[model samples]
Target chain A: MEKGSRRSFLVFSINWATALIGGVLSLAAGIPLIGFAISPAFKKGESKWVDLGLADRLKNSRFKKVDYTFTAKDGWVKATKKRSVYVTDAGNGQWSVFSRTCSHLGCLVRWDDQKESFLCPCHGAVFDQNGIVVAGPPPRPLQKLQTKVEAGILYVKDF
Target chain B: MGFLNERLPLTEFSAHLRKPLPKHINLLFSLGSLAMFLLLLQAATGAFLALYYSPSPEHAHNAVTYISEEVPFGSFVRGLHHWGASAMVVIVFVHLLRVVIYSSYKAPRELTWIVGVLLLLVVLGFGFTGYLLPWDEKAYWATVVGVEIASTAPILGVFVAKVLRGGSEIGAVTLARFYAVHTIWLPWLAFGLVGVHLFFVRYYGSSGTPQNTPEEMKTGKPFYPDQVFEDVVGMLILFIVLAAVALFIPVPLEDVADPTNANYDPRPEWYFLFLFQLLKYFQGPLEIVGTFVIPTVGIVLLLFLPFLDKSERAVLWKRPVALTVTTVCVAGIVGLTLLGASSPKLETADATIVQEVPQPTEDIQKTATLDTETAEVEKEEEVFDFQLTEEEIEGTEEEEEVFDFQLTEEELQ
Candidate 1:
């Protein structure tokens, strides 16, 4: 048979067409399967403002770590989660609220009164009073939360 | 027997069993068979453990505790699995080292070497996901850190982290997701890869020892008696070691996962300690260098080893670059692991969030006055609008409801 015979062309066309159809058909199921598996990644955490009691309670120089419980919906379960944040009231209506979450590996950070900085115990990471990285392996500063004072009570946005 | 042999490939299988082994084949060559034995043993033990294991945050720890304390021979089985993981890692690495020492990954066996490297990774994946099944403090925190590490990758980092975590946080869903992947996805992958790897190994035959000449390599004995005996003995020794450790030094189940417990100091498994220690070196903005860039370069180099050292030199010392690089990498890994192991464990045990000491009466009064003045002024100035509007709050809920996948009250009814 000639290399580019009409019958050979038909056979070539059929083979490629079958491959394309087969590929599209597999993708039809494969895409949904993949989407189903990765769907949880896009599930957002709960976003709400949690009240951290009276603003008067917050100290100026030292951070007052406030631990609160709030309901968070994740995947198929709704569970109450306990989380903390350090709040410093800087006198003239200036308030700083830093999420206790460590930037290096998400371990909780503790405020060390002696060092005047936050210390992450997991990797010995140290952050200054302003939540800036000072020592150890912290990649970023402590996460800061949005805080608002409406009626002497301090409210920090939680996610 | 004749009918079955004719229908199946029983005759061919016997022929393979009787295949010749190169004269230079020694105890090191049997490690591959030992690795395979361990993989199967782990699967058997893990299946038994999974019978009683519950993959949920609420039940995971309790299930493990029950297995340890209540179930008959459960702790022993679980211990085999626990230590077997470490053993598998060790055996796989040693087998790989043997291969490298002989430079057995040379041309014609390149694909075999590639698949072997992938199998090594699969074994590691088994270790990573399997450890988390216990859902103890160590496993939970390590996974949190691991997923966080994944999130450090540029661009797709967050997405990868989210996929691994299965949501905003690791929870029941995360446990279930990990369980499914550990038990199902990884096993099937390893099985398929192992089959392919063995096919390549059989097809190419043993690359023989690096020291063997072409004529010496050709001189051989049937695999049945000599090589089979050696392989069997190696597997038996491995089982004895696994059993001895499992029986004598039983694995402990730590406290159940407490995400809120800041007092717990999280540590990675010994195999991962090297990476953990390396991460400490690259602090702050350079973390990406440690977590992603260097490890990635190392893995890429490893995957392309056959191509990189394409000299067809099976002998180790002849390949100076490969020898030096492998030696340095081994030494580095060992040094980092030792450093990490000896590093203080209780550095953060007392590092709980500082309780806001009720300021002295004088300070409290001063703070009260300062707070009232700010509150009075702040009430007039715009409140930072931190609270989401009611509509926005419901809108988020509505969006979440779309992905809920759970039946609503009406639907349930």
Candidate 2:
């Protein structure tokens, strides 16, 4: 009985070894095929919500201009930067955050109170209160940042 | 001896099938097979993409960027998949033309031809769904056109649009619905239909010339060693070409999507550019007819082509009428695409132009600087006086007042 058990163990070991080797080889061969299949799912860079600043500075008006700085780490390198924005209300206490990034062609936008809009000085692209293109060569309205208020501090996610 | 040889065993059968196939299977014959190969490649790459892609608008674009930049070999894989899809569309159309020119849709192969037509529609459907997955402006507006097209479908237009969008407009539901159709539903249908079509082709064995002429007819070699070898070589060549394109010229990404922006010149993907341009020439009733009616009619005509052209001859040169029709169609598509690419720019209204505010003269700037310093000193004094008191932050009221001013008139001029 002991001799029989030893033989069975040897057979099992050989089978297991063969299966393991086969599985590894199959995976190696299949990698390219699998990569071809799933390549469409891969995306290069993602837009992340970069924090802008505190909410206390943005109260009591339909629009508020606030500037804030944050550090971004790509791989091992870290850099600090500041961005300014105009946050307006879409009614009901909710805010629509506009990137001063001009819709005309990436120029900085300034608030022209007389025009009641964000004015792109570069090509004269004008956006109304809702950020619709009111005038100029700008193909689109201003980019809006996703925002949230935390503990009286305004935080915006910049793309 | 002849009967004994004909009733050969498995080994003999294998040996008999190992002969060289015909050499005359032209470049046109290759498009369908190439399309099929690319479809498989798309499915594989798309699956990998789906693993990491988030359908939610909040994360969709970011996820795409992440896969491109962060994932291992992600960019190459995504690029291959994207370019592969575009290539498949081109090849499928070419394949259809090849069939038409050769009059391969006659009697015995009618069903095969019909299946091929459906496959073309599936390819377009794939292009449409895949275009919107990136959630870019181009994708968004192209989808707007798609939704608009669906809404023009008479009694069921509204229902179709709602079902496709998952709601009234493009949103999370629309994204999810598109994702499902793109990655799941359409793929299964395409695979099954393609499989049946291919199986029938093999069974019928190349429907060669039904009306064989002694001079025009050529006996083909077997399909194994000859045709299979050529197919393998073709696949390798296609791979090399695709790799070169993907590496040398990466797909372009448009600016992020913002629905509030109306000035964006939203164009569909290049594959649909012809259709997009077609809509421009159409006005009111003509728009509906050109955009929806004409395309539908074309598709139906293609489906019933076998009956329309009941020629027995399979030699492409013998089918002059069909060949001419196919050539015209190809030329028309190519011309329309070129026109679409060079579409005339839409005129912008003058009222929307924002005027820049001129800076005051240097002397005025110095005066404003003095005024700002005085105001700062006064503000400091007020803060010092109110330090012990629980008075709210000063100037908040003034800031509120300034914000209330409508800056429209000054901006417009």
Candidate 3:
């Protein structure tokens, strides 16, 4: 390279090196910091399967409202909360346990015996006997909780 | 590499970087860049804060407390993000004012001006949404009032309020919704708007000072070292000031939200204080005028400013109407904000500061003499009561004297 070209090349190299080194160092520090920060969002809440009385007690071809209480541990504080769920017998020994929380918003839905349907007091969203949306503004069906039966007892995961 | 360079217009990019900026571009011109820097800082700190933040109403307050008291350097990071938001709002507004004063929004930059307004709106949105994340009393009430104001928009009032709050009232759903908007939606919108603004800036080039002469362009310097150096210096000073505030006076978190507290007085952030003050003049029927009409008219006028002020002259003195309007509007906002801050809300229970009535001259002189006499007695007692050895004496001298002086001062007062 000519003398002028060489001088220009040296200046360009210094600038490039400074930017490259700074970018690399920042990436090295920032990536893990961000990862560590957002890791909790991906982590599930510290809740476990809570047993909600007997599965056999749920009447066949009908909805039985059950209320379960569970203690939730959030950070350093432990809170005992009571929640209601609607359990239905789908015949053939099958069952559907639905969380009372409406799909549109988390407001509790009540099963109206007169209407034979679930009604949300918040936005008037209605769901049918099978946890499916019948009418109103609900985008989808009611949320179903993960359920398991052990020795005639029904267990559902609570978060 | 050569093919890639050719395809990417590398030569043009270098030319843009090496383009000479007007020599008169000073620190005020760097406000836009400083705002951009503060935005980045806020994004980083907000992401970190979001890591430990729980959006549910039950855990939100606890989670914020955990971040402040448990996580490593959490309070410092939260403080930086909080302070960075206020800084961004001020800087962006100043940047807008600078553009208006210099007539930089005129021709070839009208779209840039519009995009800047959109960006300001997004920044305010970020502030409104992020204020609720801490789930405190002030944040909750301020949001309730904000949603109420939105609900006063004539036909769509009820619908607008419901959409904003995610329900009939602010609750868990509102927290989750605001969190998603604050962390995800608003940031992406701001990023796109900033990109368009920066592109327009690069394309049209920097708007020089109002006093720039044609001959001055030839004597300007490239942006790389000259302008970049000033930006670096300005950013450094800003960072130092921000860090000092974060370290010395960290952001405060009030008590957890209590929706049943009827006596709580809610106030909007300082930037919106002008509008908050305006709402005071109107009663029931005229509230729509205060909440919607005036703000909408102000925004429409700001959006069309570049078109309305179409003068070719960039000098401030030559444009009397534009200058006068801008000055009056800015001064009105400042005066209103000051008034709003100093005045107490209607429902505020203990807003008054009771002043201590002064005594007569004879009584004041008697108190002063008594205070001096007590101080002299304490001093004598300290000198005579020192019976310890020199080594023990030296160790407690500072502590004893300071404690005695404070004790005597309090008793005298």
Among all windows of 10 consecutive residues in model 1 chain B, the one with the lowest summed lDDT is B377-386
The model with the greatest lDDT is 1
Note the residue pairs that clash in candidate 1.
Answer: none
Q: What lDDT does candidate 1 reach at residue A155?
A: 66
User: Candidate 1, residues A1-159: lDDT per residue as tens digits?
Assistant: 577999999999999999999999999999999999999888676556655655775646357766665555556766656677877888788889899889998887877767778888677788998889999888778888988775556767775
- Stretches of candidate 2 off by over 4 Å are A1-159, B1-24, B208-218, B314-320, B347-413
Give the per-residue Cα lDDT of candidate 3 at B367.
35
DockQ pick, better of 1 and 2: 1
Interface RMSD for model 1 amounts to 7.5
Task: After superposing candidate 3 on the true structure, give the runs of residues whose Cα lies further than 4 Å from its correct spot.
Answer: A1-159, B1-11, B214-219, B345-413
Q: For this target, which candidate reaches the highest TM-score against the unseen true structure? A: 1
Candidate 2 structure quality by residue, lDDT tens digits, A33-86:
666433323423344443332343344445455444444332222423335577
Q: Candidates' lDDT values, in order?
A: 0.80, 0.66, 0.72
lDDT of 2 by residue, B1-413 (tens): 66876676756656655643333456566676788889988999999998899987667888888877799877878888889988898888878767766676776788999999999999999999998888887777678668767767778776667667654546666777789889999999999999999887775556443344443234566666766667778878888888888777766667666653434556678888787666655543454675579798889988998888876656666767876877787788888889888875433411322211121223433332345433342232222211111122244565677788677886868
Count: clashes, candidate 1: 0
Interface C-alpha root-mean-square deviation, candidates in order: 7.5, 15.7, 25.4
Tens-digit lDDT string for candidate 3 (B1-413)? 79989689888878878889776676788898899999899999999898899998788999999988999998888889989999999999999998987888988789999999989889999999999989998788678767777877889876667667765557666787799989999999999899999999888878778677766653577887777888888999998999888888868788887653323455667887787677666543565777789888898888888888888847565789887898899999999999878765432221112111111123323332345433332232222211233545577787787777455666878
The superposed Cα distance between candidate 3 and the true structure at residue B19, in angstroms, equals 0.6
Residue B299 in model 3: shift from native, Å?
A: 0.8
